[model samples]
Target chain A: MPDRLLLAGLEIRAGERVLVRDGGFRVDAGEVVALVGASGSGKTLSARAVLGLPGPQPGVVAARCSVEANREVHEPWSGVSEAFATGRLARFRREVEARFRAIRGRIVGYLPQDARGALDPLWTVRRQVEEALALGRTPGRATDWLARSGFRDPASILPLYPHQLSGGMAQRVAIALALARGSRFLLADEPTSGLDPTVQAGILEEIRATSAEGVGILLITHDLRQVHRVAHRVVFMDTGRVVETLDAADMDRARSPEARALLASTARIAWRAFA
Target chain B: MRATLLAGSAVLWLVLLLGLAGPFLPYDVVTAVDPEAIGLAPSLDHWLGTDHLGRDVAWRLLMAPGAFVGPGLLAVAVATTLGVTAGALTGFVGGVLASTIRYLSTVTASIPRFVLVLLVMTIYGSEGWLLGVAAGVAWAPALAEAVHQRIEVLTRAEFVLAARAHGIGSARILLFHLLWVNGRRMVGRQALLLFGYLLVLETTLSYLGGFGVPEPEPSWGNMLAFEFGQHTANPWGLWAPAIAIWVTVLATGIVSEVFAEREHA
Candidate 1:
């Protein structure tokens, strides 16, 4: 009913170099927003800034940013987390952090780009998933989430460490960690980047199924084909600025040169696949 | 290297054996001084001869571990706890606070180690706790600086970012994830190095004649003090205690090297 996430009047500057100038977007509950772009585009930085990864470097500023701490309860979420405790990484306002604290693992989840590297190599899958649940204060069996994330045999997989898991399996475990925390909105940053196509398809299907269940996802990917197939709205970015926003239906009519180039590249990939 | 390791292990084990046997051993170092046999060459009756006080040099060497080991262990334990806590907290919570801590450690470290020991000695009255407190304070700053550098590197590690992204609290992440996971081996190596420092410090104090356990206590340093400048003629009196100190220090050095090598492997 309300916006799940919002970013308006955003400007990112590193020294004299402006990375993102006048960039902003929003996603309501139960919607897929795929941010598409080329290399050195501001897509990843935008997502990281929202997630509060790096502190605003010494000479940077943000105009407006807000996240729905709990969409169902209508709690307030405002102010950048960098201000909470910079060296500690991400921490929001006390009330906002408290509300979001109640919501994360249950309402919002983050799936990092490097799924295998994201997992602690020394820890078993079971321990990692369980700790996520503990941190999220979510009540669910870890095995159920593992299965929900498409693990056929969670019992066998849970005992293995990250090293023992194949690329696809590690990616799935990352998803399971998100689901176990009660994630209704997933911020997946290239969930299938390095996996084989078959595995990539399976992962995409899981994401689609997640969306079908009314969970909003801000899918960060460079793949236009995946964007066409999954994203309801495509927000195209170029050189750190949001240059175009298009409905999935109007992709062929992409107005900007960058968007058109993305379409053409995906067209080439599709042709290669068929030929 | 293997032979060095064996030699080191043997010297350490021999010290431990003598330490265990010290209270029960037959030699009465203070009263058994054979005035007639004083400065006699090494023999069955007196295995390493006598000092100027006519006390058996071997008897004192055997008894010295009790005096040396307790203070060394105390200093190491206190220094490690303080150093690790100081370095870890400073490194994790960067900014003005980090700079302030770095400044404090620099100030503390800049004071010469011997001066700091003397300061602690004067405060605590130079009794059993003297060496422990003095050396503990003296050693902490350097160890803290080393750990600070190590933790700073870990802050940039991907796993650390991943942990923060997952909503793990800052304290848990700093302690369990960053410090505990990586700092364990480095702490152990620091302990071995500190033990060697404490031993060397205590012997130096005894050799200087004012700071150690005092007269008739039989520390390696004081035994050397008793025969100062006489080793040219009565080398046995000087060399016995000197060899004990050298062997113990050398053993610790070898053990520390092996520890580092094993870690790299």
Candidate 2:
């Protein structure tokens, strides 16, 4: 897959139930793929699988997964059972984990679902931004990224802590942290659910801006309006499966009952009330 | 709040100063044994009255900081250091290691730690350093448990996930980002709490006459315990060490509550 993140076969199981089974999807560079479904459809879990997080699950298996062509595709537990059998111990999986960590923030940055609590409550905005910059070893470029994220006077905002900032502002800072790594792939999980409607639009604009700059965006969300506004394509998922993938322009033509139900729900949310 | 914090800090600094200055203070009355001065009421020559052995009670009271505060500080330092290290390692590197640490914390917490302090002093002899070691060892599990929980919560935090995604190694994330950065406030609170705990432990252990600095070396615990030993019901002398202990404990608690809160924006 050229300029895309591809996962051929991915399975995640906790104790008994598989959260995501036989699931795979891709987000090409500069493309936005919104994984839309009702709660617990494993949309967020599927994105986490890309980050090598095994979830709260005991085991996760990914036979093939990749961010772009020629980039290493991690399979953390591919040989786990085999490693258990040969008495060679958990060595292969350790290497797999190390390799996975080596690529995490640099290759892929995540904006977590819980925006209000995403930044450490104790850390100043400046300190957090500096840390993110320093992680990529470009510590002096805080103002550059802060401006890119749309902060007009970064000096004023930098001294404030997470709790001091509005939910919308905090979300932008989180996005800035992710982009600070110069990640090619961005994972935005419910990035705007808990913010003011006006603020939500601004945050979406930031995400849109990031995508326009060529970052592949995997937008995991339930709001279909966000899907229409930001996503280039939507992956309709239900009960641990990728039910369908269609262009955002074709969302009205979605045929699956789950897709129709989600679209109908989004339509039912009156925009006039927000106005 | 600011007033309480200031007052508590003043008391704490005073106690610390006394403890550090213990070596320079005149301690002649600690070993003074005189039948003539026994149970003497307060006189200008013998301030705060003399104890049963005629030792100057004020001089002994001055020794309280050195005898109790020193050991308490050492124990809190040792326990917190060990606890933070153990908690960070176990929490950051999960699997058998995390499980094992969880089990160890459980085992240690289940024990009435004070009993362990007593037992160690009983078995290892009544050396002051040994008592301090026992106090530190006994409290390590409590700190370990607190830090373990803090680290686990932080590991799942979105910020930490962001850090990890940035290709920061697990060690850096655990020690610097998680433990030091996120966990420092928690450690401060724990330190203050442990200081109070050690204060109580040292006093209690000393008063019970087991590892007490042994009468001549004057500690708050023995000062109070010394009167009850002689059945002398003089409130003036009895109240001296009692008030010291109470003030120290209260100051530690107030300071912790007021100042140990994490610096938030």
TM-score of each: 0.76, 0.85
DockQ list for all candidates: 0.26, 0.53
lDDT of 1 by residue, A95-159 (tens): 54454445444566778888888787667899888888887777887898898889888899988
Candidate 1 chain B: worst-modelled 10 consecutive residues by lDDT: B22-31
Candidate 2 global TM-score: 0.85
Categorize the docking of model 1.
Answer: acceptable
Q: In model 2, which regions exceed 4 Å deviation?
A: A1-3, A14-18, A55-59, A69-89, A255-261, A264-275, B29-56, B85-111, B227-236, B263-265
For model 2 chain A, where is the 10-residue window of minimal lDDT? A69-78
What is the TM-score of candidate 1?
0.76
Put down candidate 1 lDDT per residue, B71-151, tens digits, no spaces: 777888888888898899788887787788778888989999988988778676777567886788788888888788888
| Candidate 2 lDDT over residue span A55-160, tens digit each | 2224566656766523655444455445545755454656767767756777777888776577877778888888878777755577778888988887788888
Worst 10 residues of 1 chain A by lDDT: A73-82
- The candidate scoring highest on lDDT is 2
